[model samples]
Structures are given as structure tokens and as C-alpha cells.
Target: EDQVTQSPEALRLQEGESSSLNCSYTVSGLRGLFWYRQDPGKGPEFLFTLYSAGEEKEKERLKATLTKKESFLHITAPKPEDSATYLCAGREKGGGNKLTFGTGTQLKVEL
Candidate 1:
């Protein structure tokens, strides 16, 4: 079975503070790993897609990197507007777009 675990279920950061969230997983075979950001009561917004180990993607304050066993979402100098729930999902071989997701890491940026 495919499984995912996200650490530090919740994080509180002061504005301009930086941190990183982790997403660990085990799968039968990896099709892809994906990162997403979700606002309260909203659907997840796609952040990145990592197709293989050593792959990485970045945007703005977010940088996502992948390895065979895990992924990391690095947040650099976060701001109040950056507060949101970050989620990671894995697509196992033959799973298509149906992803096995880790419980999201909720981040609060206080100014």
C-alpha cells in the first residue's frame, strides 16, 4: 500500500521567518510526487510535480525537492500572506491521478 506522513502537523512562524515541512512516503512504485497548497475551505492548489529522485521545483518562496523516500517543501522568508496548509501526495504506479496524500501541514505566519 502507498502511504504518506507529514511532520510538524502545524507550524507557527513570525513574518520573515523561514522553515521547511517534510513529507515522507512509501509506495509500491513511484509515478510522481506532488506538492500543493490549500487555503481554509478551498481546494488544493498545485505547487510542483517531481517525477524522479533528485528532482526539484520552485516558485516564489517555495522550493520542493524529492528523493526516493521523501520530499521537502522549503519556505524561505515567509510572510502573513503565505500562511496556508501545505499538502503532498504520491501517485503510485498504475494509480493514475488518484493520489495517496499525507495529512496537510498547517502553517501560520504571524506579523
Candidate 2:
């Protein structure tokens, strides 16, 4: 069973609009939490990997943070280029490199 869950299955935003995406997980002994951006017809691009509660990573207008139970992807002043499906995954401790992924949240940014 999948241990990761993403909310709002879909999202729409106007250019320069900011929003946050949610990713809740139920993995036992989580080793790491990952965030990715997937464009149409392309594989997911890794954004961040948070390993502990309170950890955060940022690139450009995107920021990712992790907590004990969930992680969040915050988009600040997002542009249309940021439109894509956001995905989250968790690696189980001692479960090798296998990861459980959430279905992803589709995001659309309009002008």
C-alpha cells in the first residue's frame, strides 16, 4: 500500500500567484522525503530531499520543508513555467532504495 498522500489532486494559479502543496505520509521509519516536478511527457525532476523534521530546501521560487508527519512545497510568485505536476515520495528505513510516491498534484499557472 502507498504511504504517501498528496492533497488537492489539482491546482490552478494565476501568474505571480503563490500557493503551497501538501504531502502527508505514513511511512514507518522514514529515511527521507523527496519533492519533484514532472512536466508533460517527461520524467520527474528532483527538487529536494529532506531527511529530518524542520529541514528545508529552496531553489528559485520554490521551497520545500519537512515535518515529522508531512512535507510541504511552497511556491512563491510562481510563473507559468512552474506549471506541472508536483510529486512527493518517501523512502522507508531499511527498505533499500525503494520509494513510495504520492499520485501527485497537477498545477496550472495561467497568465
Candidate 3:
């Protein structure tokens, strides 16, 4: 079975603080690693796609990296608007576009 797990269900950071969250997975074959940011009552907004070991993508204040078994999302100098649930999903071979997602790491950035 394909699965994804994220650590530290929630995090609180002050303005300008930076941190990284982890996502681990177990699957037959990894096709892609996806990162998304979701705010309250909103759907996830795509942030990145990391396809292979050592692959990485970055945008704004976030960076995402992938490996054979896991992926990481690093936040740099975040602001209050950066607060949201960060989700990590993976596509496994034969899974099609049906992504298996982690529970997500809820981030709170206080000014």
C-alpha cells in the first residue's frame, strides 16, 4: 500500500522565523512528490513537484526537496500570511493522478 506521513502536526513561528517539515512515504514506486499550501476553507495551492532523488523546487519563501523515501518542505523567513497547512502528496506507479496525501503540517506565523 502507498502511504504518506507528516511530522509535527502543527507548528507556531514568529514573523521571519524559518523551519522545515518532514514527509515520509512508503510505496511501490515513486512517480512524483508534490507540495501544496492550503489555507482555512480553501483548496491546496500547488507549490512544487520533485520527481527523483536529489530533486528540488523552490518558490517564494518555500523550498521542497525529494528523495527515494521522503520529502522535505523548508520555509524561509515566513510572515503571518505564510501560515497555512502544508501538505505533501505522492503519486505511486499505477496510482494515476490519485495522490496519497499526508495529514499535513499546520503552520502558524504570528506577527
Best-fitting candidate, measured by TM-score?
2
Clashing pairs for predicted structure model 3, backbone only:
none
Q: How many clashes in candidate 2?
A: 0
Cα lDDT tens digits for candidate 3, 38-79: 999999998898998998888889989887889999999999
Q: Which run of 10 residues does model 1 get worst, by summed lDDT?
A: 90-99
For every candidate structure, what is the RMSD over all alpha carbons to the true structure, in angstroms? 0.9, 1.0, 1.0
The digit string of per-residue lDDT tens for model 2 on 51-102 reads 9999999999999999999999999999999999999999987746889999
RMSD of candidate 2 to the truth, in angstroms, is 1.0
Per-residue C-alpha lDDT of model 1 across residues 1-111, encoded as one tens digit per residue: 789999889999999998999999997787889999999999999999998889889999999999989999999999999999999998877734679999999999998
Q: Measured by TM-score, how close is model 3 to the native structure?
A: 0.95
lDDT of each: 0.92, 0.95, 0.91
Note the residue pairs that clash in candidate 1: none
Candidate 3 positional error at 40, Å: 0.5
Give each model a TM-score.
0.96, 0.96, 0.95
State which candidate has the highest lDDT. 2
